[model samples]
Target: MKIEQQYFENLLEEGSEEFELIFRSLFKEKYENLYSLLDDTDAFNEPMICAAFSTPIHIPVEQMVLGFLEPLPSKIDVVSNKHGVVHIPKLGYFYTNEPCESLEIRIKDNNSFAIFKSDKEVELISFKEEVYINDTDIEICRSEDESIIQFFPDQTENIQLESGLEKSVMHLNNAYHLIKKHTPFYAEWLNYTMRRIVLFTSPQLNSFASICTLNNAYINLNNERVSDIFFLEEITHQCGHALFYPMSIDRDKLFIMDYTTPMSHFSGIETDDRDLINAFYSFFPQYTGNYIFDVILDHEENLDEDSRLELIGRYAFRMYKYGLGIYQYQEYSDQILSEYGKEMFAIFREGYEKLYEKRKELFDSLDIKDQVYVFDLEKFKSKNLQKTI
Candidate 1:
């Protein structure tokens, strides 16, 4: 089945409904008859409830479930995870010492909240980090201590390093504006599914990397300076993963076999078929982004020669990488993908193949020789452009 715009609309509706069902079931399992005692069940719509459902924390599930208790306690001690932070829905996070479990929270007659720890009772401090980029609201935060880490081909140390939020925010704003202008579909997709942009750093993570933290409403990004094109590639890629993740919760209807069964090592590491399909889905949309750069080159009058080549180099470089993924994965896609999976894969494949053929001459003109090149403009020009002798 060819994927139309309606497919995304359907997918969003289906996935959201399924996640809510899963949450209700789990809530019932946790609270049992107490679940029926709730006065307002609509508290389930709180984002942190969904975040806790998707995230694996060291604390008991009751810790999260209790946050939804209709009449919150006058003075209750909420347990912190190993991260030294307590996450409450609607209420923000509270910090404490590590290895500490209890934070005494008191709700005053005025309904103001306070934290009593270390023999001191003070007003609770909550930092809700949020910003508006391209008129879209997004929270800027870091991955929780207990959240699942991103998959990497090589084993590397992952720790949150110093990130310059000012610069990163500027770059993201520019990138989102460009995405809104050129790849409006992806922009809308991101606005729908993405809620948070988590930041971290690893020295071995190279310049930059990003991954969707399973079903959590966030994606992790390496803290580094990167081009606008890099942001375009990553923002679209991880948001696609985040958008499609919830549907996998309904595994029985979506797959014929165990959805987690190891199926391929397209990234030089064993990955399940479900993940592989997501990766392919992630790559397909970037070609539209690649074409946008082509349009800018042909029509934009303000671009100097150096700026023009930089865009061209980015176009050629990404096309090669995206093309290679389709070539390698297309062979094995049918072996494991379900009918639904195959239909989606076909759309990705057909969409990319059309663009590849349409840009055949430009693709042939690129003399890129390295397989592991980043957006190295100087190297690309040296290899692809003739020198004036």
Candidate 2:
């Protein structure tokens, strides 16, 4: 579902007094007109505006608001200086001289770059039509001097190499083609939610892709790992999180009714308070995975029998995971349904049960023995029910 203008208005009206004051102070004359543009702009960008109001960090709202209006850049340099200041040439920079709990950056305008903790602004020098930055005795050419760019972490030497960038772009193009061809709805969602994809060499060996809380999706797919199905799953999964994130902020307590107690999923992944909230709402991403496989299976003639079975197994596994998760976390899910009403829950339940039945039929036909992809529904359901008792 798309975020409407009224949602933005409600967000402003229901904001805390301090939030309203900062918003009004920063936006001044333009604050009233800003909400009208929310529906027309990128959905992912909405969270930044919400963050400007909610976050305790003393960020300049004018800069953040302006950055949202500008078109997202395809590439950006994530520069970390010797003084422990992380700079993203355009979007923002932060001081990380000491260890911190959070790694949030302060939003800055495209014209300026912050150096260290000095709060100094280094202006990009323009020569003819090109923009150059001469900072710390190093000179680099910038494609656009005044355009705001988004950056992500984990940019290692290997990831920054020209070859890696090309490979990442190629994977993205393949992903776009698959989304456009097979999942048109997801393509539209991507157009609205995904601003840009940033390539990074992930520190975690298994991490392939992730969406930063704001506008960028960070991917670490190498040449060998890049495939249409892989990219499609990653994009759709991350896009689901990106789409719902902004809504969670605007509609307070939309995902979780209680932030006091921690919760664990059926998979035994223990979530802390903050992460527990996210875990509670993870059904959307699982649903996306199931949806993608369903769409792909429609053209089963193009796939070999093994590939078809593999896709079916994945779909079944996602549905099983989602259904089992809901069954295990019924208390929390019930609260969410009661508060937000039954719309989302209805979708989750209907999809999960239908897919569960279909998966059982497929399992019998295929005689699948692989435990990784094929889920044992009866076993998990019985175990989950015992847990509740």
Candidate 3:
């Protein structure tokens, strides 16, 4: 468990033979189990090797591991001026006692890059969330050791109060996902901007909400407080833009794609990485990276950027009361709409209230005092009136 930092740093620093050894060993488990060498091919291109072994690898293997100095059976092990000492566990992978001075890795599925630090544990940092709100100040102190990752808030950001990040890592299926659906979030109420609502229907886990980063979008679904009270909070947070986004941005913004709706939602694909921006009214909703906004009824979008984000937040709040999850009530004849006078809101409304009540009963039983944003229809209506019409 304890490793010498200087040892691994040498691999890349000096291009030492040991560096190659370490990489080959560590990656053996990956190539042996996860890869297939189809033809009589002994070695692949460096990129191909790195792709199979450890992806988002700084120097994509491009022939580092299987570049046959000996037969494919005999592996290489050496010490480099840069990489201290390495031992290849398998032909294409290596393990070392030290951390590489500098390494870059990306999730093969998402291609999100992380700068590997030369610490005892493998560490990666994310500045997008931090820099988006404040540049000079550190935004997130997220760190990880091996598969388990943690989220932390920076001290110097000038943001008052502290957030104790919850840590949970699961090597479930493809990758590790650590979710935070718990709070005070510092006792901060679940407004549209920060709401966790999830509706998971996996064979393994039937969950209401969770927070995780996937290939497409950063997603967070909260139910840790009310535990299924507002099942749509997270979903609506992302989908609200589908209703409130303005088509045009008055000022240039970096992250806000497509006035209110993402390019994916308009395009109709549930999740796509390359093409982002729903320029054409296709209404394909982005289902990844903070995807929770529910947009089936309200169609008018924001032409200006300011109006778009504001409306997004507003509509997200609306989802606390109305989301597709609740509207699935069998009693409603025309589920999407309830007509001018007669309200089917009561149908979904009644069901959600029951769900909320059930959650409250559970919370009371558990003695948890977290505050959940209860959907008060009257108050929600009043809040909507203040928005710029």
Candidate 3 residues 1-389, lDDT tens each? 11122331332234323333443555555555423441233333122242334323333232244332233422122221122212121221222333333332223334332333332234332222211111111011221111011111121221111121221111110011111222212111112122111121122222211112110111232223222212233332332232112211111231233333433443345664323222211121211111222221133342244333333433344333233333332233242222421232343355344433533432233211221343343343344434423
**lDDT, ranked from best to worst:** 1, 2, 3
Put down candidate 2 lDDT per residue, 192-292, tens digits, no spaces. 44444444453343222232234334455433355445555556665556555544443344554543345643234554343445555577666655766
Displacement of residue 5 (Cα, Å) in model 2 is 18
Ranking of candidates on TM-score, top first: 1, 2, 3
The TM-score leader among the candidates is 1
TM-score versus the correct structure, for each prediction: 0.71, 0.54, 0.22
Give candidate 1 regions above 4 Å deviation: 1-3, 32-56, 59-76, 79-101, 107-113, 122-134, 142-158, 161-166, 204-224, 247-312, 369-378, 381-389
Residue 138, model 1: Cα distance from true site in angstroms: 2.9
Give the Cα-based TM-score of candidate 2 against the true structure. Answer: 0.54
Q: Of the candidates numbered 2 and 3, which has the greater TM-score value? A: 2
What lDDT score belongs to each candidate, Candidate 1 first? 0.56, 0.43, 0.26
Q: Write candidate 1's Cα lDDT for 73-110 as tens digits.
A: 68765666444566554345666553345667777787
lDDT of 3: 0.26
Residue 171 local lDDT, model 3: 13
